[model samples]
Target: MKDQGRSPRKRTGGRRRPNHKKKKHELGREPTETQVGDQKLKVVDSRGNTQKVRAVTTDVASVADGAETVEATIENVVENPSNPNYARRNIITKGAIVETSEGEARVTSRPGQDGQVNAVLVE
Candidate 1:
């Protein structure tokens, strides 16, 4: 597991040893790289008894075109600001430019965390 705690260093650039072992609450998980394919979802446990729905793979997207929203078939990822390789791998993430049945759109929601792709039509 990855540690989500503070760094083991002082502001004065002095080394500081950890006093305790890693805790459950301070653990982090790997990123969910959502891809375009048949709809697949995974439910994960979150803090405070909440649940998180993650999209593993999906082919649909809700694309908002100003006054109306329509369900569009995702064709492929066009560009990704997060990583250039993500676009090549067809991974979907927020702010990514994707080609849909309606047109090109910019993703407005996190599919990995929201379990669905939401995007806005781009000119």
Candidate 2:
């Protein structure tokens, strides 16, 4: 598990001893790495009695063109500003340009976190 706590080093570049043990609220998980494929979702328990839906894989996206929103089939990832490797691996994330049935669109939502891909049609 990854730690979401503060750094172990001080601002003065000195090592600081941990004040307490790790807590559940300070835990972190790996990225979902949502891909273009059959729809698959995972529900996870979160803090404050809430739940998070993660998209493991999906093949459809909601593309907004001007004032209209339409569902389109996701073809493949075109480019990803977050990571070049992500584009090559076809991992979908926010701000990624994807080829859809409607046309090329820029992702406007976090698929892994939102459980769906929302995008804006690109000219």
Candidate 3:
């Protein structure tokens, strides 16, 4: 047979992977998603007040430091969260010490499943 060359993907009968090198994030960051998720500007209701939300948090497997991870001016625990951990019950709300552009938002345990974040609060 002649050389078939490379297929649309490498494997002939396997799952496909996203081309990470071609990703263009809003923050002008190329695929450093493991460390941070995505960034978007939006208006949200915080503490019965409306405020401009600038940054967001991505679901991570492990955090570097708790005291230096979640840093938010306000903290909100998502009840009945989509995350598996919190999805089944009400999670406790506590502020961490992370540094974000929006100030310091708490980075709580995310219910990582189906390759997505189950719940997160932006404030």
Candidate 4:
């Protein structure tokens, strides 16, 4: 498991130990891959009755350009700075450049958490 805690070091070579162990809320979850296919969504239970959304497969994207926002068919992932494999797998994530029916757009929303892909046109 990954440790999601602050580092034990200061800027001037000082040591700062952790105050407490990792909490349940600090646990990291597996990344969701929003690929092209039939729509499939997964609901994950959180602290309370609230749920988290995980997109398994998605075929559409909401592309916004200036004053207009339109739904477009996702063609493919053009580039993904987060992970190259994500581009090959067509996983949708924030900052990912995707090709849509309208044009190339930069994803601005977290699809794994939002359960939907929202992007802004790149020109």
lDDT scores of the candidates, listed in order: 0.94, 0.93, 0.32, 0.87
Q: Which stretches of candidate 1 lie above 4 Å from their native place?
A: 1-3, 7-18
User: Stretches of candidate 4 above 4 Å error?
Assistant: 1-3
Name the candidate, 1 or 3, with the larger TM-score value: 1
Q: After superposition, how far is residue 29 of candidate 4 from its true place, in Å?
A: 1.1
By summed lDDT, the worst window of 10 consecutive residues in model 3 runs over 26-35
Whose TM-score is higher: candidate 3's or candidate 4's? 4
Clashes of each: 0, 0, 8, 0
TM-score, candidate 3, is 0.19
Q: Tell me the tens digit of each residue's lDDT in model 1 across 15-114.
A: 8887788787876789999999999999999888899999999999999999999999999999999999999999999999999999999999999998
Question: Which stretches of candidate 2 lie above 4 Å from their native place?
Answer: 1-3, 7-17
> Model 1 clash tally?
0
Model 3 C-alpha RMSD to native: 16.0
- After TM-score superposition, the amount by which residue 92's alpha carbon in candidate 2 deviates from its true location, in angstroms, is 0.2
Q: How high is the lDDT of residue 54 in model 3? A: 29
Question: Clashing residue pairs in candidate 1, if any?
Answer: none
Colliding pairs, model 2 = none
Q: How do the residues 9-94 of candidate 3 rate in per-residue lDDT, one tens digit apiece?
A: 65557755654343222123221111233322233333335443423334232232323433332222333323434422323222
As a TM-score, model 1 comes out at 0.86
